[model samples]
Target: MPASSHHYRRTVLLLWLAAAVLLGLTWWHVFALVSQSRAKELANAERDLANLTRVSQEHANRTFRGADQVIRFIQSRYLELGNTLDLKALTLQGVIDAEIFPQVGVIDAMGIYTLSNQPITGKLDLSDREHFKVHVTSTSDALFVSQPVLGRATGKWSIQLTRRINRPNGDFAGVVVVSVDPGYFTRFYKELRLGQRGMMALYGLDGVARALNVGSREEFGRQANNSPVFARIAAGEEEGHYTARSVVDNVDQMVHFRKLPGYSLMIAAGLDTQSVLGNHNAAKEALWLQAAIVSMLVLALATALTRHLRQIGTEMNTRQRAQRQIEERNAQLNAIFDLSPDGFVSFDNKKRVNYISPAFRQMTGMGNETLEGVDENDFSIWLAWRCATSTPFLGVAALRADLAGGKPDPRVLIELNQRGKRVLQLGLRSSKSSSVSQILYLRDVTHEAEVDQMKSEFLATAAHELRTPMASILGYAEVLLNEEFNAATQHEFLNTIYVQSKLMANILNELLDLARIEARRDRDFRYTRVDLQMLVTDLAHTYPVPAGRSGLELTLPEQPLYLMADSGKLRQTLLNVISNAFKYSPHGDPVELKAWIKSTPNRAPGVCIEITDHGIGMSPAQLARVGERFYRADTSGKIPGTGLGMSIVKEIVALHHGTIEIDSAPGLGTTVRLCLPTYATLQDSVDQDGPSRSKLDHAIQDTRPAALS
Candidate 1:
């Protein structure tokens, strides 16, 4: 659609056309070179065939001329010796050369055969022999060469060459025959080293092979009348060449043949076309295949380049669209940072500020100027002007030492105070995606510090509580041992010692119980369905107290008031609270214990138990630490009890997911209210049931507020 894209596509098209043209030219050159090489190979093959033919012709001419000279000498001797001549004696004188001619004989006018090398014991008939009959019938004086025939005398296959023996009056005398082994010619031709299917043959004019060797086969006495090469020779083709399959061996060959001048014989030498031109054809095909593969690879690379160009153009359009929407996303991110409660600050690998949220600016007096050239040491000072001395890191020096590491721990806790008033805890952690980047978070932890201070005071108060009881026990025992008093006074002294010892035991037991309850890790309080009315009734009747003092006053709801809690722990908590009411109250002072089903604001519907005492009520400062472990309101060494009863009671109540509210005054009495979760809030937490008073829309119900005994 655009000018740049259109021009880009046109350029790609031209490149592809150029590649195709080059490939075509490559193939043309390959074919031209193959054709020229093939022409030279054929010319070389023709030269080899011609040389073989010339060699075979020379061998045949020489062999036959020697045979003719030998035959003439034998004929003259036969004419001289007549019937009285001893052919055996002539052969014995080494005249015949038996290695060349195995059997030499003479056939008489009656067609009887005889051997010159050995004595003929029996008469041998040879009338049917081609050698004998050719001489008898022929009128020419030339020597006749016949096809291979089995000798009646020697009983072996041999080439029979014979000449006529005529009388002085011109009557037929007999035949002088030379029996030559066909192996001589066949073995000589086999050594020509022609290709796998080359044909080397010697044949007579009568269209029959005298000796033949084609590839490794040797044949004798076979007709060659149907051969195209032989037909051409018979038609006066004395020396020529042609490409044709041999009729004898049926192989395609290039043949070079010639006829002997003084004899009716032909020599043919040929080489198979498959052997001579095979390498040429293979080289041509390999060149074509290699060129084709290279061309295809070039085309593929060009096509890939074209596609890559198109993709780049498309990507450019997409990049423009993405740029337009970046502003909108930036606004959304700013709004998110503004609304976040916790402060956030991020820094990159170079310790340079990348992003700073509005909350981070509000927590630290920093602005956009803090974004550049701010390292971890500067960030640490920005984290806090001051840090608690109790923690591992205190100042910017410690923070920078930790930051300069190959790999540092991800999370760090920074404690600081804002304007020397409010405390803040900052969490610094590595970003999840990278180790070289970090995120910082800020939260308030002022209330947590106050709780730690209260815990420290509790440990000091526990030591004082134990020492007071042990001092009283040791003082009374020392007074009785050093002075002699009345028996009644001595018994009173023993009673005081026993009472102080019991107080010490109660403090130790309460401390162990509180520690065990708080040490649990989870909501591990075992809960069961409890009938509140029956539980209070049993406690009122079973509690063992002193005989003359004012005991516990029980006020219970009429209904069941079922709850979910650890029953043993709940009973211990109630017992400890009620016992404290009686212990702090003087004799005849009212100690009332009340139970009811009620719901308070910001709490679920539950059963609440209250214990009231009119004895020495606590001040405001004392009530705040009343439930702290081993803390006491009376610190003047007068109270005869451990200071840990209320602490144990508070822990048991908290484990049941409940609350304890203490209301007290300096001169007035004190009332402790303990509220436990009922079945409505704890049905899934534990197995429990409460009374079904669904329509009692008021807060407190079934309160049984009666006068105490």
Candidate 2:
């Protein structure tokens, strides 16, 4: 060998010896440090285990006491409401009100079960549970707490506590059970400060751990029970931490298990042995790192891990608190809107409905049909329903106006048809501050409008009736008392005075009859079977035509008009029209009376009366204003008359279920047509009370007549 090679070999040998010696010393020191650390860890773990055991026992005791208290409370409630608990007579709502927990229920021995706020009421059997059997058989007053199990009704995991109740005869009176979720208990575990790679688990007597961190719960339960520490706890012998092979990673782990008091359950906590003997691990890594820079970063790794753990904890607490606040606010808002008086609706940014208040459903008469996730235009069900019940309420218009216009300051009104007789009014207003909702208000104003119109008509009829008769009586009395006439003239004057007095009397009688009819409000027409042709003939003969009249013609149809009607009102209506024409134009032109029966297309048969006269016809303006009470047109400068003629005629025609129409022009003749519904019986009139005839009558009654002369 070369001298250089021989020298390098010696050097290598010495370096190898130094390296081996340093590694051995480092290993021994780290071993000693780890032994001390382990001894201290065991002492600390024992103390922690004892504390945990005491805490767990206290927790279990408190929970047991709480459950017992709940049972006592339930027993008191049951006794207090014993009369209400009769299985055969209990109502669903009553039971719901009587329930102690909003999320739980009770089943009596009679098989009657009561769930809180539920709409179901009936008998139910609960003899199928193992826990119930235990509860019934146990001689102690202590509650029998069942292991965590899945609920059949809600499919949720829960732990049940059952206690038997005794009757007056010392017989079993069924059991009161309280169920709580294990997850609720799991929330307490989050406060445990386990080191890196540390974990805790809870296992039931069924050999199933309800929860685990990284491994399958089933596998953990199966293998963990076989572990030395778990075995010690199962036998009720373990008191402190001990080293064992981990069920998941096959590495050594320091573990502790505590048995739950008076229950077939256990809680286990475990930490990785590598993490527990951290000094030894650090020393082993340090030697290797002296030769490699990668291992030298161990200290930095520990620092980073600590920081990350703290950050994660802080974030979790923040998120949990925020979630709680959000839940509380949401609940409060729901209560406010649900009980609000106005109809309320909320929409999302996409214009999809999100919420609707109870008032909305009550006002619009909607049920169960979801408005959420539906396009505003697709809400035709509400639209059609609103149109049927009240005025149609138009929805908020467009997104551009709602979003870009600063707010949802929108208003709309819609008219609705109700049964083809009444129209309703609905008003909708969108919130000015919120773009997400709109409010609707519906009002039934039909009766209000009727009342207003009746008031106006009553005042008008009273004034006209009172003034017309008083004016005629005063005028005729003045002419008679003044004696402004000779023998021949006096005769004419006296005759004129007599006619005026009779007209006055007729006006007063019409007013009195109208008032009586209104006070009775009886629509029942006293029908009498009579010869219709004779009635028409007598009416025509009763017409007071002037002597030496100007070719006045009276024409009637050559047929017997046999009909059932309120003959008195019908006769009054006919006479009012005939007398009006004569009083307006007695000498200017001949009067013509025509009668016929005609049935137009899609109409019932009715008698038609037309009275026309070639007289001083009224101008359109004068005719338009004539129907108004005491309203005399300016064209009739010297006319002596009461304006009640047309008004009375309109009222009489309406009561008889007939219609009146007038046609006239300036310097032309005037024609008045009246169509009286000729029903065959009183029943026919009652059934035909549809607005078709009333609408026609209303229009005719609103029409103006010629100015009096």
Candidate 3:
């Protein structure tokens, strides 16, 4: 070959070699990235499984604790009342949640199944049952959870939670067993919506499965001794995660297992190995495709460079394309900052604002304000002006001084008076990156602050209300105990103490009722079709009239108005309103209650109950604060009330999907109207196939006075 041709051949060889090296490096990077991605996916799956296992373990522990409480309660009651415990009545009265523990029974000392919340068909001997035998032989009061067994009394598959019941002298009386349905755990697991091959199981330390749900299949009393989790437990591992084939179905999975802290049971949650890696596998394939494209582009670039040895224009175009890609990435980052809910402000190295996220502008109520390139100190002054005078902000000077003094950036909460008031948690941090000097973050915390304030106020009001009655009770009791008095004087003091005690009890009860209503949100209420006319009449007749007062006067429409409501709660609401009417009107004015069918354009047709009381009516301000807790319109010492009655009434009415309107003046008396959806209107709103519709249908078919009442 000629010298020039030899030189060209050598240069081409070097170019091909460089392209080969680049392709190899590209593949290596892709493989490393895919490997890391796979590891991350597995780690995340294990973390999720561990968290699910922890939740299941907690649920099981809570269930066991609740069952033990019921057992202890029954044991004490049974020991005191003996055969007169009335388990069935207690169950009916909701002293025990029968839905959770379907059967609670007492086995006599002779091993006879004597009493139970569930019906007993015949004399059933439970002597051979492990739950019964364990308690009978061992005097220990430790709760014993038995393997799932077919109950003789209830004729259902249940796990027996039993405790040994002893007499007052510590003599063994019998066993108190609470039967829990294993399906309960499985049902709850279904709600977790684990993948089709997911598994959740509650197993005893002895390796018996109390409840196991694999996808949709449920099993109990299955032996899992050969499982890997059991081996780990045997090796003293309380909790762990491992990938292994399941002994039950031979499906490979990543299993996270945890042992209940104080119980013998263990909970395990498993995600199918293939399902867990599904996303990672897809990503790996995409990464390989991208690597192949990059390799092709690298080879093409090498060939182009070898052919066009002196091409400067091609190099410039390549640089321009790379610049465009960088700009695109920057735009993406900017989009993310703009979309973030938390406000962010970045200052350039000069400490002047370079970027302000949309969220930051909205948080500061500075809409359309040109804040870019503004000095940090000037921005701080503007923010200070926006903040409430009550909570002034520490300006940028203080923040910089702290940072210059080697202190951490200050995080402060500032309240803004603009835009209907707001609380912002402000945090500042110095950035080490060359592009920015500092970053400011603002988070809206107004809701949290409001909640804290409401809680504090409620607690303070409760304490003050309880303290007044408590002081009266303590003073009278002390006087009676220490000083001798005549029989009449002693009786009067005793009466005073009794009244004060009752007042305190009423306050506590009303507070608890309010809390329950708020927490449960009417889940505990039993809904039924109630006759509005009949209910009002019953209230009028049953109300305890004061000495100088006439009973409530009733006005009812000719046709009966029916409503879908929890009758007990509705009755409580009406009683509260009527009682308030009488309590405020000490002059014996008869409260008039009128019921009629009402309709509104914005709502469904409903029934309205208007109760008008000629009482010491409230002013506009007091009426505005009517439903506020512990707010009484009459603050005079003559009235007797906890002031929580209206609050409870409001909550109950709202739970029924009803509205209440109160109209009053200083002397014109007050008219309170309760508008509740009619049964027919509510039935129309309910789904056709829903249980509520069926219940409403059944109620409609049965119109007897007994059913209505």
Highest-TM-score candidate = 3
Segments of candidate 3 deviating more than 4 angstroms: 1-342, 352-386, 392-398, 405-407, 679-709
lDDT of 3 by residue, 360-440 (tens): 888887889888998898989988999899989887667667768864446688999889878988877788789899988
Give each model's whole-structure lDDT. 0.71, 0.56, 0.82
- The C-alpha RMSD of each candidate to the native structure, in angstroms, is 56.2, 43.6, 37.2
Error of 1 at 594 (Å): 99
Candidate 3 residue-wise lDDT at 292: 72
Error of 3 at 586 (Å): 1.6
Writing each residue's lDDT as its tens digit, candidate 2 over 593-626 gives 7877656655666767788976677888778865
Candidate 1 lands at a TM-score of: 0.41
TM-score ranking from best candidate downward: 3, 1, 2
lDDT of 1 by residue, 226-326 (tens): 77777787778889898887788788888888898878888888888888888788867776776666567668775443344344336535744664443
Colliding residue pairs in candidate 1: none
If both were scored by TM-score, which would come out higher, candidate 2 or candidate 3? 3
Query: lDDT at 649 for candidate 1?
Result: 80
Between 1 and 2, whose lDDT is larger? 1
Model 2 TM-score, 2 decimals: 0.34
In model 1, which regions exceed 4 Å deviation?
A: 92-94, 119-121, 300-709
